[model samples]
Target: MAPSPVRPRGRGGYWLFLIPGFVLFTVVIVVPFVMNVATSFTRWSGVGTPTWIGFGNYTKLFEDERFWTSFEHNAALIVAMAVVPTVIGLVLSAALFDYIGKKFGPRTASALRAAYYLPQVLPVAVAGVVWNWMLHPSYGAVNAIFGTKVNWLGDPGLALATVMAIMVWFQLGYPVVIFMAGLQRADPALHEAAEIDGASWWRRFWHITIPQIRPEIFVVLLTCTIAALKVFGPIFVLTRGGPGNATMVPSYFSYLNFFEKANVGYGSAIATVLALIIVVVTFLFLRVQERDS
Candidate 1:
């Protein structure tokens, strides 16, 4: 018999591969996060010495009505980006995979999926600018088509709603793609067996499809919720948190405080708080998922 290959030395060499990534992560993420937390306890204007102010920034942030309003907008965004999209994506993915794919062809299903995912591939800035122009009160395509001068992004009452709708559209594609991919892992035989048992589509969806893709649903909701909380680009391009802060969210609020107002310390505090909330939310989501699993 051929001599057995010498046993590889203890797998210690593989650990070296992690060093580069670990270093990069520390420099890019860990260092900045630590600096940010330190900055939150001071009064800094991005330049010059930071004056230590303890929890003053946090104290002020809590009392700022704008902060509360921003969070309230974030809550609505969570609904639009996470809740609504997940529900709709579930239905759409199931239909596209089970019904359209079988009835029309795989090519047709893929084409439709690509169309839905088109928005996700577009740069956020470009999408925001296009939407802004299309929703313009004066020359917007939407208003022109409808022959109505509705200030889609300018009216405080309508601004948040408009933003929410835009978010829903922008976010729908992500869940659809994710859920469709997850559905690929689902056992086709289960669906066939259910069908053979005279199970209707709705019954099969509720009993088989949903359970099969539960993990994807959880992942989508978590990511979308975090994205909603940190949303800033669209608000910056579309309304700049204008029309009386109707579309303001924590990330935009922090941006305003940091650059526009030159209140670096306060901005750091806002960022810290937002980060904390995201951590808590993630922890809660994980715990719930663990329990269910």
Candidate 2:
């Protein structure tokens, strides 16, 4: 008689379950990405047959001063969003974790976490419109607080800064929640040991807290960098990349090419470049984190 055949289970079943998800992901993500790259090498006006243009679109990017400016603005946004908010969020998260999570117990901590996440639950379009009114200069809450009538969105000098400020306000909450989760997973015995040793608050944070949450730091940095790189809604709503293109970024520039200017090829080229930059930055960050770890 033939030996009984072995049946697949556990890992085999998991792999089988993942097939549908993998197929859907490839269809939605990989196909579009390849199509975008193909579009980048062709001169296409959405409705017409695409003509091969070699590197013309890419060469044109180097000569376009507005494109460079937009790229520079995006770099600035990446730095601000990655560094500034991480610092602020880390400090606030540490404080909340200490005060609410540790001292006041789980119930209060859950309530506080819910409050911080409220802004993230709101739609970006609504947030953009609300921020536009809040920073409207003459009639805005910001000006009213400072008691000075200054053009926030209308002035070229202030437009970029206003957009940055709005981004910081909205983006901070999600990171705070991330940090809190990291804090919850940290070993409590480490804190107890530090307390017994009479370590100062700063000493404890620098030595114990940060090293334990290194994974979270990497996550927050990468997420914030990607989000900032593609910022558009607030710029569109508040300034329309305006007051003479002072508030423009790569995402808005690409949108203009595709929608307003009707140059699909140029837009795809910009998008491809943006995608390359994101991939490179994320790769570098992961390598650095691995080295440090």
Candidate 3:
């Protein structure tokens, strides 16, 4: 009889590779989040013994008009950062790839892509400073160009809109880059075949291109929506959630409570609620994607 073949080793060794990542995640994310959730239930001022006040912070938060207003602003930011950018990026990426790259050359297409992505690479602080200078009512470049003084960040009526526009500019580049990359994976033959069948650019875009890049579109929308929700850097740098809280977002509101107001429990409650919203949104997006797939 032939010797029995040696049995193969199990794949159990692969489990070892996850140890480092699991430990890091537990220490960094899990621990902190659990602590935050616990803190949200108590009245703490960042020091001393904490007073237990279960759901009090949440109750107060729901009753605050500022909290509602901040959420409203976040909804606008979602439109600016996620909705507008995805639509515009899809069109721009298709035009650049199918039209410009073919007509003018890859070099021209690349240059335009780089220009669009430039703002994304700039440091937020630097961008904010430049924008602030350019929008200053007294001696701004925009005012000089238009021959009109406009308080871009100081006026309550115009501040949120101005921030939304700025967010659109900053966010447009991200989806453009992501969608262009996704388009590279698409079958060029489909577009060519559609063209051969006398399909217009819009028709091909609607029928073929959109379906091919559906996954990328979903990814961009989900990530951008989350980014818009937690947006703090731009608010901190540009408005500090001001013109009388006109641009107050949940993240900045939480920040103000944590540091300025020294209401750690309230801040933690805000953060916890924000986290829950993000988790719910992510779950819905994943469910939709799964159903679509």
Candidate achieving the largest lDDT: 3
lDDT ranking, best first: 3, 1, 2
Task: Tell me the lDDT of candidate 3.
Answer: 0.94
Looking at candidate 2, the ten consecutive residues that score lowest on lDDT are: 4-13
Identify the runs in model 3 with alpha carbons over 4 angstroms from their true place: 1-23
Best by TM-score: 3
Name the runs in model 2 displaced over 4 angstroms. 1-5, 8-27, 99-114
Two-way TM-score contest, 2 vs 3, winner: 3
The lowest-lDDT stretch of 10 consecutive residues in candidate 1 is: 4-13
Question: lDDT per residue, candidate 3, 1-293, as tens digits?
Answer: 99866545666777888999999999999999999999999999999988999999999999999999999999999999999999999999999999999999989998999999999998766777778888888998999998887898999999999999988988899998999999999999999999999999999999999999999999999999999998998899899999898999999999999999999999999999999999999999999999999
How far is each candidate from the true structure, as Cα RMSD in Å? 2.5, 3.7, 2.9
Angstrom error at residue 26, model 3: 3.0
| Better TM-score candidate (1, 3) | 3
What lDDT tens digits, residue by residue, belong to model 1 across residues 1-293?
Answer: 99976667766687898999999999999999999999999999999999999999999999999999999999999999899999999999999999999999989999999999898888877789889989988889999998898999999889999988888888899999999999999899999999999999999999999999999999999999998888888889988998888888899999988999999999999999999999999999999999989
The weakest ten consecutive residues by lDDT in model 3 span 4-13
Error of 1 at 95 (Å): 1.1
